[model samples]
Target chain A: MKLPADVVSKKNGKHTIQPLSDPKIEAKDLDFFYSEKKALSDVTITIPSNRVTGLIGPSGCGKSTFLRCLNRMNDIIPGTRVQGKILLDGQDIYAPDMDVVQLRCRVGMVFQKSNPFPKSIYDNVAYGLRVNGWKDRREIEAKVEQSLRHAAIWEEVKDRLKSSALDLSGGQQQRLCIARALAIQPEVLLMDEPASALDPIATARIEDLIQELKKDYTIVIVTHNMQQAARVSDFTAFFYLGQIIEFDRTEVIFTNPRQQRTEDYVTGRFG
Target chain B: MRLLPKSFKANKRERGIELFLLFCASVSILTTLGIVAVLLFETVDFFREVSIVSFFTDTEWTPLFAQKRFGIWPLLIGTILISGIAMLVALPAGLLSSLYLSEYAPDRVRRVVKPVLEILAGIPTVVYGYFALLFVTPLLQKFLPGLSGFNALSPGIVMGIMILPLVSSLSEDAMQAVPRSLREGAYALGSTNLQVSFRIVIPAAFSGITASFILAVSRAIGETMIVAIAAGQQPRLTANPLVPIETMTAYIVQVSMGDTPVGTLEYKTIFVVGMMLFLSTLVLNVLSQRLRARFREVYR
Candidate 1:
């Protein structure tokens, strides 16, 4: 199927088509609201298959709200109203025929703070599988191991499957969250400042993990740290006050922004 | 001279009031200590008269009468049976109610449901006893066989209902304390509301839940009027709750019904039984406190 150009990827250092050649998700004129206040305004963006795209802005610029709109996570918030179109795999997701449960399975998310369940590491990863109806003990174990391996946390946690996930180091716990998401094998992974909760070293590990994971899954990350975004993302979208002021390859957006507001914000003149 | 010439130089009357308040505070603490000391002394005295084995294992509980048998098992078993029933009914319903309040119920529904449940707590135990005797016993008799007018089932069920607010309120606080970030994390992974609550939030808040549970159980044990009025003072050692049984508090009330001469072994039984109840709750309270201390996250 011919896919609309992922407008978010028009920025520099923006990578090429997926080896599979199909866009996983597309959003057209997407608007989001929390009661009377609009959090996202006419923002159209696309999440390409198997690439790391970063959304950067200051607090409440609607980056997180937009990310939430991708998987319908904002629906739980009282008075949250969303409009326009969100598509997954050339199918219009907002078209009333969508199944939210299947949409969530196909697209997963991680958060700013590392939230490893208080149970054993094995159970934490095993949770999503069980909910999706995986019943066999052997299959659950193998899947947990496989997911942890994909998140690059398997070797460290292999000997301690029964140990509480909370007992792991902060970096490891963040990776465990990734593994838990990976356990469901989603097509798109949305991360909202997944590294902000970590120390520098831990942040570096997560950055590396994100870079590696993009080869197999699409990644959309929201970060306030411009350097981290420039370093890790293949493409970057700079959002300001509920608008995508500029979006392009990371190099172009940094060295040669098309919009003046994007340059001033990039240079720390005004947020 | 310099040390004495501090800020209160012009406030002698205030100083006197401060000293008086300090004295009152000390007196309150001392009064508590004095009461504990008295209970301890009398309890030890009673233990000397009644062997520990007899206190724990005796099946009959009459002490003031000529046929006085001091085996405390009847009262102990009765207390356990009622508390057991209370916990059995309270735990699941209370936890689920808390989960719904925290996770599922809408704000408007929560405002209504929460107060409705807490209203259970506001009604006096005596009122609960009356309701148990007058209403619950009759209702239970339709389905349950041999459920006497003052069977343990009515009182225990009423006590369980009475403690619902305690369990729901506390467990809700515990679940709330599990951190919204943890819940957000669970949801980002595509977890359902129940999955996020039961798997992540509940276990993360386990210590608080444990503390809440122990507190509920203690409340159930210490409850008296309902059992006294609804569960007759039979003092049986059986778990057949459909029949009447006399709990320890009810036994104390039974002895106190008429003048059991003070300082007699009969009057002293009150103190001994009181000590046992006190000690049991004390241990559970301490355990709950320690569990909360060890597991509570210090969020900076």
Candidate 2:
């Protein structure tokens, strides 16, 4: 019910990150290819710290690819090649010496479909922490509970931490995924259609959680749902044909856009 | 919807054909049920003549040649020993090969390697038997002294190789069935590739993989000609692999070759042994199905 105070403010069709709100991540001319087929071309963007940004686009528009590029998820995909310079906190993330494991830890991801490990809820939440060498049981349990409370799922699953995560409803499962990501204490969260598989009520709950989480974490999301973007994100980037057509404050992108393509898409004329 | 006579006749004929097909399907289903019924009835009859106690407890199994030491344990021990050895050789080698194919192999190499593996599956057990007897047994003799020419070790190893495809192919299917999202989830959480495969992917596909292993076990158990030729038809009670031991199926093979007289208990022993093999495998198969269902995907 309460939105965080850290949401970035808007002007005309652009978002100006305050000097104190210096961007945590910046992409400069990021280009991607899947074999011969181009996915993203000459795309550049900045993500301000402690704010939620949403990437809105039609199918095949490469929003998910861009999100994956943030954490090098695209590296696992075969025939995927990228040419670009991406920086995290002023350091080039694509540098030869970059450690992907540490990069992934600094930048966590939740997928469109909730993928809780086929483990107990307690084990699922403890997975990331234990893998990272968190040996103290009391500390791990506290962190997991803190994360679940942050994701707005503590009340629902508190009584059943030892139950199989697969027993949870889809909405609860997605929230649990968010909790799992938070347990890692990632500086940024990349969500790819995180609520596309959920019902309206679940979607709304996720949107509220995103709004609440903006105070502590920088979040990037890709969504086909126009209303979700406007509701959850402070800034929105409209991508079309592997290019960011418009990057601006979410209200401006939805209510009034500079590009006719962005306008038509937000107005629901076509993808 | 106008009921044109020509179209009406076509629709009526289609319905008639569908009904006839259903009847044929039902008849085939009844035939299967009938075979099971007959097999069970004959096995029960064979057991009626021999007490279940002697059939399981006694050590000797000389159904013919007048001495008639009619114990079933030698046959069972032989079957278990060979099958156990075959599974031991097959399970890890097959699973690791599949892991290489699915996870580690380059695309071009996989394209070449998979079919080569399938060729192993297609080779007849008889050819494998000859290869084991003539080739592998000679190879084994260098290390194991006084190894019987017809021994369980060579045949079991060859049968294990023969069933590798069964394990690898089925495991590959199950492993591939695991969605990319699951692996990505693990990776996104900073787990290594080894961690992903061992911790998540394997567990995610646990049901399918376990079923595959079970199927390979069943295949190793039922394999006859390989053991019949390479493994002698000596029903030994010892657990040693260097000596000749006859599996239940190999004993059945010996009886079917017309060495045992018709209508004698020597002949009836085949049915009894067959029933034991069938029932044991049936129980194994049921356990596999239950494990398969227990670990079935619930995330979706």
Candidate 3:
């Protein structure tokens, strides 16, 4: 349980820092750029293990960009670059020796729009396992079933596992995407507005699922809804114009935020 | 109780414009029907003189010989052999190049290379015919000394290269149409670039790739100039690629350019061959259209 050097140094400083019981991910001075335009500047945050950390921000606030940076998903975009370090459990993920494929295996993600493969529900859930070289048929089947149950969509889809995933309703499809991510058994799960496109009841189901998921997995969620952040996250980080304005406990952020901007945003003032 | 005045002149002008547009749209359709009608009538005339059973069952196709024969197996086998060889060469190479273009190439590189590759499609097929006869055949002869100067392999390989652009361009377009979110999902699941390509992108673009393959094969079946010049005018029912052969289109070309008298049965043979070629391509085109429609529905 060795702490990352930056976190250790910050703990000894003058600022009253709440001690993280176990920090699973730490970004130190992370600056992101898409070609010439800067998207994130000097972002430094510590995400605790087995807890839901919510990122709340307005449009173009770099919350989604920050979530993608956790798993280096932005590397796929041409002319995008990252400066500084993102340490997953004490290892630098951006280090030259770090394998991107292995990093992704440990850090899985669900997108805003549910993008199930043009395949069956069973196949979609089993894709990550097969690609990772899983050979045992029974094991894969068990894992797919377990993941679907964990995502709370097992009973809805168990009878139709072989049917095309596209036939599912929007909420079911999003839950299926969550199951797909869960089948890989990553240490950390990143969700980018997983319920933005869903209705209120569907959104409630997702929020409850997040609460259940944090028992074993470190969850980082980017959401535009302040209430969602308040409901699901243990810790909340507020971002504006690509910089973090405040990071505190969820109730502290919602009820007694230090910054005026945080209060304005939480109170439905101005974004 | 008229709410507004109706202008008869304006209504008449609108009707006139609609009729003009309809006529323009029907021009191509009318021309296609005219061609099909001509082919059908001429094919009927050819069938009247030559019995239908022998036309298909006979193994020899020496309609211009002293003892006339009407077996189409030789020409049909020749067409299959050459087109099969062409597909063997084109399918893998075209699909690999398309994968490279869609998934690997940088934006700047793709912009330059894609248009350059398409230039191959613009090159005249007649030039490709001579290239097969003069350049490729001689080059192939160095390694394969037993290769004939006018053989199926030379033109088949050349025809593959000639049609390579069509397959790659269309396949690349299909692969590129796969959404970025799908690719990101795969990548986020610990899949490498190659894995994402083979497991996700290719499957997503399956119908498009299949359609491209069918269209390319149909084009190869309809190709005349290259096989006519390099495959020789000898219609032999054999599978060997290193021998002279005559495809269906090549046979039609040979007969049409020969001194066969008009209104004779020998002269009418070209239309029958033409009808077969038209039908094969028509079926392939319809099949490709269906596959493309399915692809659109899935992705749209």
Candidate 4:
């Protein structure tokens, strides 16, 4: 397949593909509405594969709404409407032919608050696989172990796999939710402020886990803390009043922005 | 000493109101204690005439007849059989309706449907008895050929309908108490609506659902008017629900309506049966409360 020129840039004339430079998801002229009020207007951005993209803005700036759009989570809210094209792997996700359940499987999500099911830790992680029709007990168990190990919560939870997920500490519960999301083996992960509720130690653990996860999966995270964006993300998008003010490499966004609004916001002048 | 300002001092009127509220609370406690005392005193009198072993073990109960028998199994069996039939009708119907109301119904539909269903509960139990005798018994006889004119089946079905709203509303509350976050989490994992409702939401709300079921069972046990009218006054120790049987509540109502002497053996039997009903419901209510506490702890 011929990659779109704007989406895939080259170092030289040689044909080479780096996953960081390849666009995995593209949103074009996206306008979102909750009933009659507009939440996101004419927003366009591309998320690259195998890279962490950070979305940072104040509350109600539509960063979380935009993250939910990738997995079509907004569809659950009654009276919410969307008018745009969200393409995943060059296919428009909002197309009539798209299977939303399958799309969600491909693009999994973690919420601002960790929500572990009121079930044993093992059952919580295996829930996705079971719903997707994995009936073999041994296969489900192996996948649960692998996902827990991948989320870096295996050592703390392996001994108490039968214990309720709610019994885990706040940080461990968040990691269990991540493992639950990962057990489905999604290509992209959408995290809406996954560490906002945790303490400093737990926040640091989640940050480290995100870094390790970006090697295998595409990650798009929405955060209020610019420091977290600078530490974790390869690419950054700054949203202001339902619009993307700037999209660039994280270092450039932090130090050398072309737009005055971006510069003012980066310097902590005002939201 | 400086004079205390009005704002800094407790108001006498508020104190009076607090005393009145405490008095109101004590009234309910006093009523419960009074009921327990009556049951204990009358039960002692009845046990003096009848042996405990005969009351429990002997299957036939013919207390008002010439050749009187004091066996309690007939009344106990009738209570159990009617309650069993009522639960068979109520639990599935009530739970399914609640699941539909809470999980699937649109806002407009739920607004209209819920009150209409609760209307069933607001109807007087006496009215339910007449409906069981007139409408339900005849309708059931068409399909169940062996059903009697006055059988446990009709009253059981009618009583189940009477308690349907109780089960539906309480179970719906429990299901709704399962957080929206849990459903969203399940949806994000690619679960269909059915999968999310059954696997995640239902299991999370299990204890509350069980509590509601127990409450419904207790309500069925204490029901009287429907069984008194539709189920005949004969007390038989039979498991078959098609036959006429008399429940404990029905016998109490029967004895109360007649001009029995104050200290008669028949009058004392009412208290004995009342004690049994009270103790069973007491145990069920305690279990329901414990389950509710465990459920609350899970989410917290």
Candidate 5:
């Protein structure tokens, strides 16, 4: 768990690169395209292990798109193309021999709208394990219970394991989705504005769960609220248009960013 | 009547228009009631001559013979046999086409294929009957030398092809209406295309698919022209689809074409058979509606 040495930069306007404590994922010189239109350009960043990293920007700034690139979720969208390297533990995920399904098993995602399967609460949590070829019924039940407990929703839904997930309230549904993602025991969890559709109370609960989840899973969250980013993230990256304006510790990004655009965005000058 | 308060006031013209719309809505209901009344009145007269027990239990259906026999089973069995053959052809073709159209086919391919499939439904059923008599029957006779000139097999296959669009189109709509988020959710769990389409998408849309299947079967039961033209007018109780047999609708058409007296027992038989067909379809439609309501609570 040693921090990598800082790489000195010659660019005067950009912030100097800082060292990271054991980077778990890295994107280098990445370029993304949706058909003919360019969406992201030469983006590069390191995601540290056992920490929550927040990506903050206004609408259509490619924050969610960037999050999806980590696990190749963007590949599902037709005619979209990617040109860059995304590495997980020194192995390139986009390599020709790499198995995308295996990569997705190791890295799970929660959508912004909390898309739970229209199944029972128990089955929803056990879906990943079943799909990955788990056959033992006892083991599946145990893992489902453990994942639900980990997501902090087991107590509320323990009595209704066989009930449809849709019967639960909105916050419970989002938690059930998190439990489903966790059931696969993924090492990395990607959250795409997981609280945007929830109420203030539900949003607070999700924030707390995110803080608890970082101890076991490397978390990367995309959000529109700068205050929420500061509240939940250890590291913050500010994106503008199609590039990262600044990437640094959460405290530095909020209080004293080197880039003028980062300052304008953080200080509420303009989105 | 007392004058209403300002907030509760109703405009006279608006009330008139509302009453007119209500009347328009009741027209179909009134027509259905009128049909039921006529069927009941004729069915009572029919039972007076042909005993109710003999109509259901007797196996022979020769009402025009010197020694008359009245059994409904022969006609009912014929109807079931033709419909069964039609379903055997229609179900797999319809389901596979819908799965491909919804899950596997690209947008350009769907655009080119869907309308072409629906054209089968738009073609007149009488034209389908002619096709059975002219093309499909001859093709079958070549393979099976024992095939009859006018057998249930030809009309059954033709009717199956005719209803392909109904089954495929309805099933495809049901599958397509499944939210994209569910597909994404399955993919996020590392499922392949086949797994997502079959395990997640199909199960989620099962109610709608079942309803469409039942509706298609009802349509097959009600088809007349194709069976009448190709299937010979001989009421037999056999299950062999290769033989010529008259379905209930075909029998109705057969009697209607002749110059039988309006109120005779020969003419009253049509009403009784028609009542049975209507009742079966009504039961099927009600079951389909119930299934549709049960599983929709999951998504909506």
Candidate 6:
């Protein structure tokens, strides 16, 4: 593929036809626990810059748990603990001096269920900017428009910016959530089954959106749908029972996985 | 043969049980209507004797005196003054404590503290009246040398304390009822705990919190014992909290206890005041209900 110039620059010529260099995030021997129960065990994977990396597994397989660990979101849950390291752009995120707030701004999240604030659509997009102290009204307005456009929902919402966000349809709400995350200008986006709640058409729209978004932002998505993982991801990691079973290029993982378990899962033999 | 009989006995029993439940529900509703009816009837009689214009416009409130002035302002102002003070004390304290309970408190701490707070609500209002008179007034007198033994300030503060559980408990419930997903969404945007709380959780729970505030204010306005005992029976039109003043509830208590003969206009003053109290609280309750219904945000 003839890579786009921006993509080449973003990854420092580490585009397709070469091995990934300078990963955006690297998890090394990461272990996680919720109180006494271990959720993720010795999970290590590299998420390359400017690519959609999909984490695929069945329920309770710790794929979602691993996604949350990237931003230290699990910190909010009581009695949860993380062991080992998750480094974002070569710095340890769990270090004592590292601010989790700052880290989250660098890595935004879209939930499985679109959770827009019970506020106006304009205010919902402006929330992240306001919290991050973006004071200029003109700048915020421009950014809000730009973000909504980037998420591909600006045209539908432009006329009724002051309307309650809860009034939007399911697909539009999910896109608004993406715009909300994008407004912060995060370098990475974490999506946990972002389309699992939507219909087939809405899911297709979201999948197309992921493709568009990956050109600018490193995307990490967790989905149970094998075809979704095959369609959207550049790199795919198959997680089973709190561990990564296989990590490879999406095509290889779907077509010719090395591990027997990966093959079994990909072929729908067993999960 | 029919697989199942018609079971007319079971149907009759169900109908009987439903009728019993309906009767139980209607009893409370009927009692409320009966009270309102009596209040309306007596209030009409009171207004017939005392001109409606003078009852509202006149400033003095001495229906018991030889030169009986029938102005309602003095008692209304007194109720306003005490309720204002109580709200000033309760609103911030209740909201902040509710925020703490909902957002900051650990599971163990909440478990211990919630029941302890409800115990404050369960304490008898008569006991609170004495606590205001015997304890809080003396404590205030140390700081406020001009404070009267029977003043509105002490009881107002004590009433605030008494209603604090109501405000905090209800507000905390509202805040806690804010969906966890909303909190997570705010947090995911790099919002600090305070930002997430005030901006997102509070706004989301706005209707419930406002309902709690209105309910608390109504409770404070209708409160009788604390004001009756600790606040003097003087129906003064002044806003001064340090001086003695009588609320509507307190004035009713005073008239009901005094040797004034029933059916007399002086005796009828209690019903008039009771009618005013009933109307104000009824308005507040309806307003709160409207607010709760209108602004409640439903989440899936």
What does candidate 4's lDDT look like per residue over B1-300, in tens digits?
Answer: 344556445576678889999999999999999999999999988999999999988888887777878888899989999998899889999999999998889778999999999888889999999999999999999999999999999999888888889889988989989999999999999999889889988898999999999999999999999999999999998988888999999999998999878898887888999999999899999999899888888776
Per-prediction DockQ: 0.56, 0.64, 0.82, 0.82, 0.58, 0.81
Per residue, candidate 3 scores C-alpha lDDT tens digits across B42-127 of 99999988999999999999998999999989999999899998998889989999999999999999999999999999999999
Interface RMSD of 6: 0.5
- Report the C-alpha lDDT of model 2 over B1-91, residue by residue, as the tens digit: 5669889999999999999999999998999788677667777777777887887788888886677777888888888888888898889
Rank the models by lDDT, top first: 3, 6, 4, 5, 2, 1
Question: What residue pairs clash in candidate 2, if any at all?
Answer: B60-B71
**lDDT winner between candidates 2 and 5:** 5
* DockQ, Cα level, model 2: 0.64
**Superposed Cα deviation of residue B85, candidate 1 (Å):** 2.0
Say which prediction, candidate 2 or candidate 3, comes out ahead on TM-score: 3
TM-scores of all models?
A: 0.90, 0.90, 0.95, 0.94, 0.91, 0.95
DockQ of 4: 0.82
Q: Give the distance in Å from residue B171's predicted Cα in candidate 4 to where it truly belongs.
A: 1.0
CA-based DockQ, model 1: 0.56
lDDT of 6 at A126: 99
Pairs with steric clashes in candidate 4: none
Which has the higher DockQ value, candidate number 1 or candidate number 4?
Answer: 4
lDDT of 3 by residue, A163-223 (tens): 9999999999999999999999999999999999999999999999998998889999999
In angstroms, give how far residue A134 of model 5 lies from its true place: 0.8
Score candidate 5 by lDDT. Answer: 0.89
lDDT of 5 by residue, A100-188 (tens): 88999889999999888888999998888988999999999999999999999999999999999988999999999999999998999
Query: Which docking band does candidate 2 fall into?
Result: medium
